[model samples]
Target: MNRYNLSKSTKTALFFLSLLPLQWGLMWWFNLHPDDLELYYSPFFEAISTLQLYSLAWLPFSIGDVFYLFLVIWLAVLIYRFIKFKRNRLNRFISFLGFCALFYTLFNVFWGFNYYRRPLNQQLQLSSDYSTEALVEFTCELIEVANASHLSIVENDTSAVNFNFSKSEMQNLVFEAYQEPSNFPNKLNYPTENIKSSLLSLPLSYAGFSGYLNPFTKEAQFNSLMPQYKWPTTMAHEVSHQLGFAKENEANFIAALVCINSKHKYLRYAGLTFALKYSLNDIYKRDPELFKVMLADVNEGIIKNYKTSRQFWEKYRGPSEVIMKQIYGNFLKANNQPKGIETYSYVTALLVNYHNTYQLF
Candidate 1:
């Protein structure tokens, strides 16, 4: 009882519960208008984008992350052994996770606070003055323009970076494609009012995040922890969130388009190849024959690229990552993302749907 006395988790949750009403009240008091959707991650993202400190950043830290997970578990197990199997350490773990949840809650409140009271931007003007159909059309046109800028719009770089691939060649092709436009960050900038930096880390630092447009900082934070092959896409993805594409799916979609057009070859592959993979997956699920038809359109070099990517990831797979993915999947769902972690991959749907309609709004 003494060990669990002053349960930190309980205390923190209580604090957040106490703050919820206050935050909500303030949002209403300030007349902060929500976006068309409940989420407006742009403000929060702007708060923590001070990642320029890390240049030349991409790294495959997945293996290191696996080792770290083992270290945590090993320490926990040793503590339990020493404590004669008492569960006190379990409570401590919960406390840490709880603290993270609390911070996210406050961070979200801060975002809501700013968004609700934000000065009307051109985006707001577009949202109100244009019809949904009109807005959708404009958005689609922007996407096409973004995509067309990259030669990978119809092709992923297969020959430039030679890798003999296996079953997942398309994946590699996607990555190699993005290398072009990503060489230079897009010259374009989205409508933004303010930028701030924040310190938001997940429980035990599973992933780190920075707010880009919040009351905290101005530029977007970039995470270099992901695989080197996947960095440019993520850079663009985070930037998309900074640009007011709140939903993960929408952000993924925008990031893919933006990177493919980048002057960097890697960035080009990242966008098209990833989009192609998802499109193929969805198409196969809906109609195997159509999926077959689409697959037929892909060239052999593209096939080789996908296979190489699969092989690369296969070499890096570890049990620790599987467990982490399951937990992370749930975490995303709890964070206003209904499809959980799978939502990130659904950007393909938007791409496929876009192609079907020659006449965008």
Candidate 2:
């Protein structure tokens, strides 16, 4: 047989082109295909369920996010060498990546054309014309409705559902601080070295990116410096992603609705808190003073929490975020969202639209 010689460019090109089916399957087909995504993942998740792990942590997303920064750095050096020494293999590889990137961008744009309405009709996410005090009052009232009546709570899903809920017992959970040493679902803690990362040094991540459920470890990481008060909402949002809610808008709506109905006070507030944040603009239009009073009620702890998170990101932020955004914007467009990163804030629209079609739970 003749020596098989394939350039890196050709191999890379082939790999991404093969992934086109995955792109189509996840974006266009799943929504229309009647729970088709779940059908594809049943056996896979069953296997993952056996692992039994939980995490309040994740790999440092800054320099340590999938070793992406190192990969990019290496790519840069490789490109420089190729230009300086005329290496055909490196040139081919770069060419392949460039092609893949271009294709990814176009794929999002094309698919978004058919799916724009998903975002357009989501109005509940647009805040209410209520003050902060009113927000707190309304949110608390909803939680009480869930609590006093014990509306309906089943251990909802048997497999890892990851949707955030207030502690099953409300009063007991309030005073009890969340202990970091709490065991995983089945109690697996070997104590990998934990390091504190600077949030300020980093950049704003893709909103739901923190939701990744590591296929290998079978763990979903949660990192929200926003406050324990804010934790329930973000936690649920991320967990929804872990549960395989791929689309950001769907995850946002599900997270909030789930929390609102949770038994625990904090979890209930967590969902309502997030909803309030998003709905602030609408509230301001109706009553600005109410918003100010609501702002005053915000405990100092919440402010400090934001500070810690900001400082952490400031530690490792640079060009990575913008570059990644540009690349991923294309990917989002390539997938289902035509607006790219802008699709996250649009989740409220999804929430509003869903509520309109279905009676609010």
Best-fitting candidate, scored by lDDT: 1
State model 2's lDDT. Answer: 0.44
TM-score of each: 0.52, 0.51
Compared with the true structure, what per-residue lDDT tens digits does model 1 show for residues 8-103? 576775565566566556556454445522354443444333232122123212233344467579767766775785566665655555655565
lDDT of each: 0.46, 0.44
For residue 310, model 1's alpha carbon misses the true position, in angstroms, by 1.3
* Number of the top TM-score candidate: 1
Worst 10-residue lDDT window, candidate 2: 177-186
TM-score, prediction 2 = 0.51
Q: Can you give the lDDT of residue 276 in candidate 1?
A: 60
- In candidate 2 the C-alpha lDDT for residue 241 amounts to 43
lDDT of 2 by residue, 206-320 (tens): 2313323333333333444332344455555544444444465655666676665555545654555455454443445457876676555444333343454455555545577
How well does candidate 1 score on lDDT at residue 355?
A: 37
Candidate 1, residue 342: the lDDT equals 71
> How much does candidate 1 score in TM-score?
0.52
